[model samples]
Target chain A: GPKVLQIPSHQIIDMGQMVTLNCDPVSNHLYFYWYKQILGQQMEFLVNFYNGKVMEKSKLFKDQFSVERPDGSYFTLKIQPTALEDSAVYFCASSWGGASAETLYFGSGTRLTVL
Target chain B: QQQVRQSPQSLTVWEGETAILNCSYENSAFDYFPWYQQFPGEGPALLIAIRSVSDKKEDGRFTIFFNKREKKLSLHITDSQPGDSATYFCAASGQGTGSKLSFGKGAKLTVSP
Candidate 1:
């Protein structure tokens, strides 16, 4: 099974501080994604990246959120001046292709808490 | 608007009994459906999936019955075991949506031994 690794399983940050979540996707994966899940809600798609560009993003992906995979290194999600509503578990996933039929491998998830 | 919906938010079944979870989608473009299973403190993993073209798919103790015309599907887990207790999420992706899956709230299953 392919593995996607997420750093900092749990993160606690002040409401106005910046935070970055890192992901190490499968070595051969081409498409990367980030999803957010509240304590009792369904996992919602935030954004998807491919070839250095954002392919698609949902409304949940706020203006303060950004993603990048610089120089084939770790895929990172950065949130500037976090808000209390940003508190949730973030899961990173990757797939070998951009097709709907392609299987996605997800990381354990990083639980973010804003105080 | 939740594009994908799952029913019976929670279910309990005796060991060796069959557990059925149902799902339906509103989007007509959705062609791929994948069911994921998650244990507490862990990420969801793909259990079994079925394409719109197929009416049924089976993998060992798990089977997916799909009704393409009805835009609905169901997962049946037979011979349930305590280890199978977990949350099951039904996800969908359309042709143009690629792998950006829309997930359901999930159905929590408990297997009583």
Candidate 2:
């Protein structure tokens, strides 16, 4: 079965430091997304990427957050000067094209802890 | 605005009973609805999904009842087992390319023996 893979299962970083979360989407997938789930909170959409460009983004995707797929590279979420509120489980997912078009494959997730 | 909303933050059902989770969305453009199940320490996995064209979809012991007019949907798990206990989230996606799913707050279900 096709699978999405994320790196660094868990990370603990200090406030004001930078962190990069990486995701390797399914080989043939054309759309990638990032979601954040804080403890005891709903999973929030952050951003979506397609064709090596950001297609759409949500308010939660702050100025500090950035996503990129460099040369068919892994989709990545980078946060500069991480805040305490940034602590959450970050999930990376990929879909064939559209949600109604195909199912999405999600990675195990990268748990970020800001201390 | 929260596109999707779920009722009863949590639910408790006896083993062998049926568990129903409710969800509603305000966006008419949302044509895709999917239910996801999550256990502790793991990302949510797709349990089932339904398109707007269908009113009912079933697989195994899980079923989805969708009301297009009312903009509501429900997930029913039959013969609920203790192992079926987990957090379930109903999500809706807007029109177009991976447009970022809007998820409900989630329902924590517990099936007791």
Candidate 3:
């Protein structure tokens, strides 16, 4: 089974600070995604990235949120001046292709806590 | 707004019994449905998936019954074991959505031995 690794399983940051979550997707996977899930809530789509560009994003992806995979190293999600509502577990996923039928593999998730 | 809906926030079934989890979607464009199982402290793992062209898909003890017209589906696990206790999420994606998935609030199942 393929695995996606997320760094910093738990993070606690001040509400006005910046936080970055990193992801290591499967070696051969191309498309990458970020999803947010609050405790006891459904997972919500944040954004998807492909070929160094944002392919699609949901409304939950706020203006303060950004993603990048600089030099194919790690897919990172950065939230600047985070809000209290930003506290959630962020899961990273990747697929070989950005198609409806492609299977997406997910990471364990990075739990972000804003205080 | 939730594009996908799942019933029975939690379910309890005896070992060796069958457990059914129901799901419905509001979007007709959704053509691919995949079910994922998640345990505490772990990521969601793909259990089984069904395409719009198929009404049923089975793999081992897990089966997915899909109704395209009604935009509903159900995942059935037969011979349930205590190890089967986990949260199941129903996700949907459509053409041109760039493979972005809309997931339902998961149904947590507890298989008692």
Q: Which candidate leads in DockQ?
A: 3
Native contacts retained, all candidates in order = 0.71, 0.60, 0.71
Docking class of 2: medium
* Cα TM-score per model: 0.98, 0.96, 0.98
- Candidate 2 lDDT over residue span B68-89, tens digit each: 9999999999999999999999
lDDT tens per residue, model 3, B1-113: 78999999999999999999999999888999999999998889999999999999999999999999999999999999999999999999999656698999999999999
Q: Could you tell me how far off, in angstroms, the CA of residue A54 lies in candidate 2 after the best superposition?
A: 0.2
Off by over 4 Å in 3: none
DockQ of 3: 0.77
Interface RMSD per candidate (angstroms): 1.4, 1.6, 1.2
> What lDDT is reached at residue B50 by model 1?
94
| Model 3 residue B74 lDDT score | 99
What is candidate 1's lDDT per residue for B5-100, written digit by digit as tens? 999999999999999999999999999999999999888999999999999999999999999989999999999999999999999997866559
Error of 3 at B68 (Å): 0.6
